[model samples]
Target chain A: MPYDKIILGAGLYGLYAAQKCGAAGQRVLVLERDPGPFMRATYINQARVHMGYHYPRSYSTAIKSAHYFQRFCRDYGFCLHTQFDQIYATSAHFSWTNAAEFRHFCRAAGIRCDDVSPSRYFNPGMCDGAFLTTEYTYDAQVLKNWFLTELTKLPGVEILYSHRPDKIEAVGDVWRVTAGEITAEAPFLLNATYAGVNDIHAMLGLPSFQIKYEKCEMILCEVDERLKNVGITVMDGPFFSLMPFGQTGLHSLTSVTFTPHETSYDPVATFPCQQQSEGRCAPGNLFNCNECPAKPASAWPYMSQLARKYLKEEYRFRYKRSMFSMKPILKASEIDDSRPTVVRVMHRNPTLVSVLSGKINTVYDLDEVLQQ
Target chain B: MITNKEKNFVSAVVYLHNDGGRAVEFFRRVTAVLDQHFDQYELVAVDDACTDNTVDSLRSWAAGQAKPLTVLHMSLYQGLEPCMNAGLDAAIGDYVYEFDSTAMPYQPELIFEAYQTALRGNDIISVCPTHTSGSSRLFYRVFNANSHSAYQLRTDAFRLVTRRAINRVHASSENLPYRKAAYAASGLKMADLEFEGRMGDKGTGRLALAADSLALYTDAGYKVSAGVAIVMMVLALIELAYTLVIFCAGHPIEGWTTMMFVLTLGFAGVFAVLTIVVKYLSLLVDLTFKKQKYLVESIEKIQK
Candidate 1:
């Protein structure tokens, strides 16, 4: 039997590719190793629907991804929760200084950016409030679930569980793939795993490189009540913005830099582990999550001091429940394979395309790459 | 019974007044302590809409006293905010301080000090009549560490906001009062004096109960249970670690050679596993709690 397309991974992006292929009434095969789509990495991300901060970082890709995400939610009937435009501090200037003009940029793009006053912390005088394009943060798991739940029923789309793909090779005119145990052939292969694609790229002898993933472990302070009588999402600064997650009464927070790239998968990096769990012992290392015995987090060296200052009083905000960590792509390296130019006889080939979807902050120069 | 030597005083906003238990006794003490200096001042009692004999006792006390003591009652029990607003509206004194019926040996002089401080600075919003027990502070120190990493990014954005700057933090379609710290800055200056041997448990949020109890107990309104979360997380990590072992070992024997059927599932499996792993790690280090910005805590349909 001939398969039209074979996609690796069932993440939102991979599923999307499958659905697209399946729509053509083509045989679509989706292989996922994890039990189901409920836990796809991107689905488990901050669930922060990107607004339009991408213009300042990487105008083109930000626009494309933002447009894609917004439309995807609209098309799929997913309720993305977001307040108005975001808030930035006049007190500080980040790598990009013209942040104030982001409102105009949004306006020119037919989006809204209404300015308002800053609350006590930001506004002792209360003067800074602006409404720009808002990010729609939905339950990423829910959306992923919806897609899996809905798309699995589509015609010609076959979703297999416990199937791990091993390698891909182009035999004759058709592309042959050896995944788990079966060797199958298809015309086209689309690789979109944020990190897993590197292995496939390597298998294809395609220059695929792994960009380090930085994970910031955090506990969400579940908001006990609404922000009191007001319906404003509270965001504090520039690079990191903390808002209230819907219904969960949790703050969609932004405070620490998640250096997942440098983060190790060792059990020693378990302070954050214990902190993630019911704390083992209190104040063992109140200043640092890393030093906390029975519970420690391996973050910045200075993070402990910060933990002492800010995290010390976290219980003040009603801890309804906690969500998971959010991962952003920090670097995307170009893939280059250097094999002596061989005639068509001694064969070798590299993977054709690699697609990535992550927070806009990491796409420093996306158009430049996409164009390349 | 009008002691001419009594210190001048104003009204008190009583909190957690269920049935106004011991209101009469508290008023009797108030009269004895400040009766001399407080002649024209009225005793404004925020009834908190107590279900007990609070209103009757105040009226009975009013009838006998040469001074007029009025009760500002709530139609429905609205919580500390409405009770405070009602008291603030009714208070006719130069000073208004929170008076807890359950107050623990608080010197009458402390209230007087708050009054003095208010008189000294019009910008002083309110005084911390009570000090957080050192134990409470320690809990917060730990709490702060957990939350700081999460909020550090945004706090830095607003760090330069001046006292007069107007930054409005809105949550549920309405504006909150300057994010809690706004009260800390807006004409509300708090001073902590030593209330020796007392654990600062006046009305509701008395943290003087135990040392680590503050961290564990969501008694007042702290909905974010770091303790519970911590427990759930450990279980999740264990599950995740096992899953990781399964994934890395590539042990599941299910044959997946049929390319189209399971291609995506394989990669997605790793993705899911990574999520569990990453999220598990983030638990201990989570600094800021989600503001619980959506749920309207007051809109609960409590039966009257």
Candidate 2:
């Protein structure tokens, strides 16, 4: 019998979609190109359950985050590593919002904020102000494991590893998804393929998104005992965050100005500008910009140079390894550097729904959209 | 409450917004207490958009501190709630304490006691003011009575939380209008200590803040609206029954039946309108805090 839903990604959101559908007593088939789960954007992320602190400019986003922060902890409390405190420090040089403005934003968004000293791990000379806020980092691998375990227990759900959809077609009310030598049919299809969203859209003869893919890297660092169990973020205008490295007990440092670079596949776009693709991808083969294996490049020097300026006792931090991935962002959201999850159901083709999940905490938003 | 041995480092978070003339002495007293209680400690001072030189004073004092000192300066005045949250995030200590530095009787001495209380395996150690203002007490009574969550909040702002309790508060902080209430609702082991309430300038808008916090923790407005609407409907039904009895007895007053029918229909209309408004409010609250499924950024670590 044809499946009720064919989800085209086994990433966090896809897995969640499958679980939601399966729990609702619908048959779900989740297909992933990677041999296992969390091989894409879902795995290679800071894994922060944001509480709207990141979005000082967008009150709606921040408020929504304040809500999601509670639900995420309650539902996936086991997958969270709340051992560390997360700090948001205002940049003395380039932050768009001053310490007071950011605090005001948090208040308006109904997010909790506390004025804390920067001497614990941050250099007071560099930071104008610092705040300790309500935010947690998730162990992505552990979260994926939890999802897999929970999804497995549900009836009428099948997750296929190494199943990449080469072609997707809508025939009447059912969607025909072709993966390698296998072809599956489902009444509804969800395109949760993160970076590969446009690729799948192109395969299904759909309009290409105005999405831009930035070749980014997450620099893992081995810090001494002093920096353990602390997640520190310097608010934007060249932002940087030194967060606890999931369950590894290390630290992950990321810089906004350093990681984002326009790829050749990206339309002619200005730096710090989002670009839209008005044209559709050519039908036939998948045209995913992130198809190539990412090579670890020289990001440490730039990252460390910026980090040392803000961190206290910079000597303790040592570079370990770099993980490269493509970060998909809307052109508009790139300006403020904050975007809510984009969940769009095809109006003409009700069977098809596409989601560009911006954060891990946004799966609930997808659940709501799917229900609609 | 799962209590572990006290870690070496203790963190004290002080909210300093508009603490003008007393700002300097407040920090000095608080730090002195912190110095006495623990060998290793960090003081997190949150400058809550103080127009005065509060941030400057904090910076100058922090410069000389032997222990770690972190000062957060809010760009805009975010009140006490955000300041508490910010302090929680910056604290790295095994035990974290929060108190207003400008409270008339600067009680840095209480920090040690609160820490000791927490050390005894209490998840939350809160300092209850000796004299609770009559109005504030009534507000808490109503708030606790109407609260929708299982754990009811009883104490005030001053608190010392353990690492685990801190985690729970941080997890639930965003949606909670008041941090103290969220702590009480966390289902952790709680202990309350009484402190002499020093008379100072009572902050204005206490009632407004109380009402706002109550609305935040429970569906107070929705519940009242629902209840009132139900009463109106019930009254309208009773009036309709009386009017029907009178009409059946052929003794309906001239134009009385018409007026009663109109009034009954108006009550029904009001009920319908109120139900729609209540639902809309509920939806607004739901969407306002609905967790969006994704964010713009991504983070990954090196494979072990």
Candidate 3:
């Protein structure tokens, strides 16, 4: 049967789009490359719900995030973890934004930012200022379960796992995608694959986006009782962020310097590990980095040493494990240090729209394109 | 024959300042040597506010390599000492190599040789050329004569240091104005490796750095002030003795002249001693309150 919309990935964007379309009584088809949903970029990230506190250099990005922070909390309050205090501190050295600038940015963006004593949690002379902000983390597992249960009961939505389209062709105002023995056709095609956006475009014989890929690692740790209810992020420079990972008891530790193990400038993701992946991953098709055999060594020593340099000795943590994923960023955003969600209408006849965003709460940017 | 590479992680830090042409060649040679000798390594290039295209060219060249290359940009035109100190602080490895210049005058084998020397129980290893310029030799001679450190200064092309030495130097001072002087005074075991090559041209701000190092690390400044005070005291005693002899011999010397001379000499001697005391107190204040000396604009890691 023909469907109204066909979505490529089963991550948050794809799932949310499917739910929206299904609720509207439009037949929707979702194709997932992995066996499960939210198994890659959506689940293996620093799950902090952005309250516009992360971006101090770009005013638009911060204001947009603050605008969406409220809507996302109101919609998904069941899985939102708001029990911990989130602290954003500016480093005393090597920081682009000083204490005064950070405070000014927060005030202009109209977010909750209150100055606190830096010496309470950080080593003396390490940080210039610390602020207690209103931010929350979402439990990806609980969110994933909620999406699964809601989408499964919808009569108009159908999901296929472990499925990848090998051929995509345009046929008279409809897109026909085939993978092995199954084929699907839809008038509107949405590419919510994030890192695989270029790969999908290559299959359709369309122009590739000027983007770069980074194989990033997020280390999970077990924090002490003193830091269990606290989250700390040193901002506007090469610093680290340690925050709660979803509803899980573990904390996610990531550093701007040590988190990214390797980078590929090609539009399509390329790495040395692809040679030994045995067809599981390649430039045209990406497999999960967390389950790959040839992933780079853990950068625990570098990250831990960086955190210890700023935090006091009492705020202790032990390394649990590392989660790896592919991150793609627009090359133009490098100068302004802004992460703007880009929704490009590549094709008008078949209605091909590709969504690319870095932050989680910016998922609502898909609404305008989908409405069109 | 089978060759086994070392398993230790290494970080090589090089600073570039308006040397766009030489930086590419230097990076190529250094990366080749590091790749052949270690299982894992990283290159950290410090951009000392270059007014040329040095960083752009290096970034393009680094796009084809697989190992990680981090570029640290200084906010302003800070000199070699503070810029390299910032790069060294960013490095995370069991052993670190500090390349003083972008000119590779020596063979590539010298890099691994220095690493081997570091493994043989030395916390710091300085690689210098056998030949030195006349001015540098004179400066080192003067500096070593007054320096109380066990290790002597040299015209080093590059050096290798263990993590322990880095920690010790950081613990010894709040601001590292001169890395070589700090390492020499770190009280850690150190060795020197000499090669048979000519050194390149010296970098900018050398005279000012030389002056600052001598005043900060050597006892020459204090000694000069103390010597002047002693000379003033001796002159005051001589004048006192002369006044007593004149009064006893009845040479018709004016009473006002004798008293004025004695008072002037005595006050000058006391003020000279006070000058030395003030100098010592200021040095203590500087050591205790000075902040970090370097400011980095950003750190960018390029991996291809």
Candidate 4:
């Protein structure tokens, strides 16, 4: 059946966009490569609802995140977990931004940042400063269930799983998209397949963005009671972050040095693992990494050692398993460490909107384009 | 392809400084040796604020290799010791190799040989050249003579150490100004392998590092200060005795006894102040060595 909007990849952005379009009385069709929504980058991430503390160097991006942070918490309050204290720290060595600079940036961005004792969470002489900040994590499963229920109840919205567009062609004022035995046509097409944004653009004969791909690993572990009520992030350099993974009673341990097992600078996400995937994944058609057989070995040893170097001995964690995903980063934002949610109108007549963002709270950036 | 290769994770950390013309060649040789002998190995090249294209050359060469190559860029032109300390801190391996220079005068097989030596109950194995420069020989002689540690100093090209040695060294001190000294002082089993080749030139700021190490790991500085303090105190006592003898012999000059008494008091005060100053100086040294000392700008893993 023909629809007013066809959203590709049922991630947070795609699902949220579908809900908004449906609320505006527009018929929407959602295509998901995975069997369910939030199966890829959305669920396999740090799950940090950024409140501007992560980016002290980029003022604009931090300000924007601070602005959207409140709205996302209020809208998705059911899935948001805010019972624990989140701490941001600056490493004593190799840190780009010192404690003073981070505090100044926080004050300028109008965020709550109170000075806290570094010895409370970190080993002596490891971190220069620690601040208690206000940041929360979202339960991806709860959010996914909410989206599924809302979209199922809302009229004029259809979601098809395991459907990826094999072909996309602009015909007059509509996009004709086909995947295997399914075909759909829509006046507006949205490409919300983050890591696969360039791949989709290539298929549409549009210019690809200058981006790099990292095969990232987020390790889930069970933390001790001492660390159960806290989230810690060592910032501005190569450090580690240990935080609660939503409300699941587990912690996600990630390190800047060990999280990314491999990197690909190609226009599309390419890796040596694709050769061993046995048709399960490829550069053009990216597949799920968490289920891939050729995934890299767990970096738990390196990551845990790094965390232990900074964290106190009382606060401990045991590894459970690893969740893998592909992350795309804009080359331009590397200098200032800013993650900007980019929404580009690739074509005006057929209205092909390609949305690429690293942070989850920035999904609201799609409202301006989707409403127009 | 050899079916039997070492399965232990190895990390080779190479230090670079204005060696742009030679870094690619060095990396190629080292990686070839590592690949042939080890199943899992990573190369960590430390860019010590090189004023040349060393990092660029290494990065370009690393882009084609299958194994991972991580480049650690120092924020400033820190000398070799601190840069290598940072690199070692970043390395995660069961066994780590410290390559102090890019000039590999010996055969590549020697790299694996050092690892094998390290596996044979020796926590630290340093690969050195048979002949060393006259100045280095003299420096080692002086350092070993004054050093309280059992291990002797040598002119080594590279060294291989197990993870246990690294951990012990870290636990012993927060700042590793001189890694060779720290490893030697760690009291772990150490051996030296000598090859028939000439060693490369020392890294930048070698003299200052040499001085710092001597002051830190040896008792020469403390001995010299104590000797000075003792000689000054003895001279003050002798002068006071001479003044008393002159007064008793009826040949005392006007106000000479008073002058001698005041001089003796001054010397006693100076002796007490000197003792306190020495204590303060030692405390300062302790504080300096108990702080984090390296600053890295960034660490980048080259894409294969």
Candidate 5:
């Protein structure tokens, strides 16, 4: 029989949704543009499962995340890296939540919080208050494999690797999905394409979303000594982190506010939804996706300056490789980073469910979104 | 003899189910908290047919109290939903405080603050949870997201309700198997007093309880499943269109026509059967639990 649901994008949100639907006895098929999972934003971003420390301005957002942090641990504990204590220290400048307010929020949210002596942790002049949180990081590859294994165990679930959906049509009450020469039809269609959400919507002649993409880069560094798996984050401002990068001894140094390239909707303006924009690369209107640099441009030096300010032993951090990524964020979440997974069902056609993916820890939100 | 002052008294309803040693401490703490807040009040403790000495401990504590004490014992272990209904029926107070006996040593000050919040034109004052089981949190989100009713769900089991709100909850809960669901859907003006709840001593079948309550009150999962099935059947009609187009276009693949026909028909048949099964299953559950919605075996008043 034709699959009951066809989910586009095999990112964390898409894979998680497929597993949930398949378990519920719905025949599900997941299509990934990439050959495998975690080739895009899911792989390149800082893997910290936020626990209300990042968002001090939005209480509801902080509290909702508190639930996600615990839920992620309970559901996927084996895939998590808890080798080091994750600290949320407030920087001296451009900080949204100071030391005292952040501590109060942690207590109200029922998160375990402990104060760290400035002399003992971080550069003494870099931060005023340093506190420990229950947040942890997960290896993207391990998480991807875990989801894929669960999905394969289900009877009618199928994963189409490297299948790029080029067309989606609302044929009568069901959706007809066309990828390359292959065609599939399902009653419900969930567009969880993340950064490519607007791309599919544009192809289907649907209205555009208030979503934008930012070219982000993470500076991977090789530390002389292991940091005891402790992931460090300095608020949401221009700060750097020396966190355990998966199972490797190397750490991923990232900044929320700083990136190699300025955040843009499209580097090449022709295909706005494709996020491939070139700046005066050709004589005519011929656009090229390769015009944009695939690797980070001078991301290491900038990261090193911020790292030195925050860490006492900055000299131990050696540059490895910078990974370039596109961050898909809602226009609203750009301010406070608070919007969770939003399932926008086309009011005219309720059969098509478009899920704007949020935090990685909240992958379970797929169950709730599908139910809606 | 009930005096004019005691006639319109505040009532505190406590639920004790298999809670053994904590019952006496619970009674003492509840009464002490009540005395500091109200001039005239009564206690209505519902014992859900405990096998332990919880009833004896409660009875001994009631003998020493001057305020009115009523204990409603169920003939069977009717669970918290029905036990709450019985307590609500027996409580004759101007306002009512409903909380679990194992609710961590609730300071009288928070109770008074809740009362004051209610006095300031709020119909319902509830203590919201700072921490709860992950399943319980998911239940609230699912219920709220799918709920068409006006009442929004909260994670607070501890509540102080005015007489009007209490009446609304009682009236609305008469037909439902879940009391908290009914109360949330009762269309009452409610406000939450945020508090970090301590974990209870006993680990009840909370996951099962939450699932059962959600299925009874909000058929969110069932509705989504049925909707999905209906859409699938509709999609089968569209697949029929594709089959014809491909056939007329002289499809390259052999036996494609028969495969499409069987696939379309088979999915439609499965969905039709699945929808019917879910419908009847919901009815069966409702009919089975129809009698136990508010069943109370006996009630006894202990006073000097």
Candidate 6:
């Protein structure tokens, strides 16, 4: 079937483009090479939806996308969740010495601040005090499903999952998409697989670009019932930022940084930065989990030390579960990874367009990427 | 008023690995208490492996128990995962609760409460322990145990994921105690019940037993081990001696040198041994101070 738009790769960006183009009354067909529709790359996310207002860019698009998602959930009858309340914090040591500096950073980030009682830190030296933020955490996986469900329901939309687009290009001025025995023709094509940008570039014959990020993370869960009660605490610093997915069962204490290399996004390479400390103890009475020997921090005592300075002598560490990973991205300058991201090659007409983004960035603005 | 319509019944599944000599006694006590109520239930005993009397004890106990007790004796130890899975598979009740036979036998009320609670339709209800911390009212209000927001969020995800398919996925062994994450992932609804005292098997121990310890003890219950107290105690003493040495050494040694020495030693000690303390603390805090019910053979839930 010949359509107006053909999207390459069924990840966040590709799906976002598919949804928007379909919403714009264009028949959109999305081809994915994954064995399944739920591409594990970016769809199964930590669900950290970006407000994007924090950045210098025109956030109107992001706001529109966020609202688009909200509307999608409401209209489709699926629930997508985001944390209404967020608390940003820093170690007590830093808060005491650099109050103005901290306040300034918060102000610029467009977040509100207060000097209330300091919340507790799971890792002893991880962070000290917390200031609340208005940031929301929308569940990415749910949102993705909802978005796809809603988008395909429209008249001009056909979102297909698990199709390897063998050839997609402007063949004789008409774009042809071949997937096994299935064939779809379209005029416009889009690619949004960040990790596989080179692949898409090669397929579309577009210039390949390099993408880099500073640090990625491994998730930590503090097992003590005390910690579970404490809920989510946000500790902020230039180096590490501790945030909790308390509602979702992920309390990630960040000292580790992960960057996806230009060539790879293998979540295992990056390790958490060692937390630096010289003082006896931070302000909060960090509770030691002297219960289970199997918790993550307790399991990696030496590694945890490298992430932070141990103030207490022989203090027990408590951890529940840990999902270990280093972000699979580049920390250095953007260098082109020469792989075709466009699953298919459109003949000569502009049938598909693709963009690659670091995992830290959200595919909220689907319309902006695909519309232009 | 009992209606003619089919009312949802609630029951728990209790799994017993090779629970050493205590297997028979614990099983007897459990059947005795459960039989008193005459509530519909299933008890699955998975004998991982035993060179001892565990199987013999089960054979005799199973011959006479009034309730439905299914015994699965695997030839070898597949670890706790397979044993729990075996027991879970055997559970035909609306709610399948997990318990460790090595801890004290489950308090009878826990069964009644858990069954009643599950009938009300909680996809996954975390059992808040009422015994350990002494401050019941205070602990109940805090977030679900494991303070990590990830745990909190994963719980909801588990419920959503699991409840969508009522019976197919059973419960994930990956997320326990706070099975809420797995519950969300399974698309299950959630409700929490607070245990009044404690699950029976965990009630003993010199300190307090946690779900973690309960799991371990239950996993090890297949053994003839009244174990680990001595090794743990000796390790504790050595650690203590090390602490005192630093404290005493700090007084006479010059200023910075003593502080430096103490700090270095403290880091090394905490780095090496502190995690065990936290794991144990997670166990204790989960049982004593927290406001959720721990698992037993049967946990009650509220139905839709």
- Where model 5 places Cα greater than 4 Å from the true spot, the runs are A265-296, A347-350, B1-304
User: Would candidate 3 be rated incorrect, acceptable, medium or high by CAPRI criteria?
Assistant: incorrect
lDDT of 5 by residue, A38-71 (tens): 6776777677776767777777878888888888
- Global CA lDDT computed for model 3: 0.87
lDDT of 6: 0.44
Better of 1 and 5 by lDDT: 5
Model 4, B45-149: lDDT tens per residue?
899888888888778888888777889888898888888988887776778999989999999999999988988899999999989998788878988999978
The model with the greatest TM-score is 4
Query: Chain B TM-score, candidate 4?
Result: 0.88
| DockQ measured for candidate 5 | 0.00
Model 6: docking quality category: incorrect
As for candidate 4, its clashing pairs are none
Q: Compare the candidates by DockQ and give the number of the best one.
A: 4
Candidate 2 local distance difference test against the native: 0.70
Tell how far residue A300 is off in model 6, in angstroms.
6.5
Show model 6 residue runs off by greater than 4 Å: A41-45, A51-85, A91-99, A117-119, A122-129, A212-217, A220-247, A252-255, A258-348, A358-364, B1-304
True contacts kept of each: 0.12, 0.00, 0.08, 0.04, 0.00, 0.00
Looking at model 2, residue B296 earns an lDDT score of 14
Alpha-carbon shift of residue A49 in model 1 (angstroms): 2.3
B29-119, model 6: which lDDT tens digit per residue? Answer: 6566555554444466666655678767767766665443555555565444445544443333444556534455235455545555555
lDDT, residue A10, model 3: 93
Q: What residue runs in model 2 are displaced by over 4 Å at the alpha carbon?
A: A264-296, A347-350, B1-304
lDDT of 3 by residue, A295-353 (tens): 88898877876787678779999999999999998999887789999999999888999
Task: Tell me how far the alpha carbon of residue A90 in candidate 3 is from the true structure, in angstroms, after superposition.
Answer: 4.0
Considering the two chains of model 1, state its CAPRI-style docking category. incorrect
| lDDT of every model, 2 decimals | 0.43, 0.70, 0.87, 0.87, 0.69, 0.44
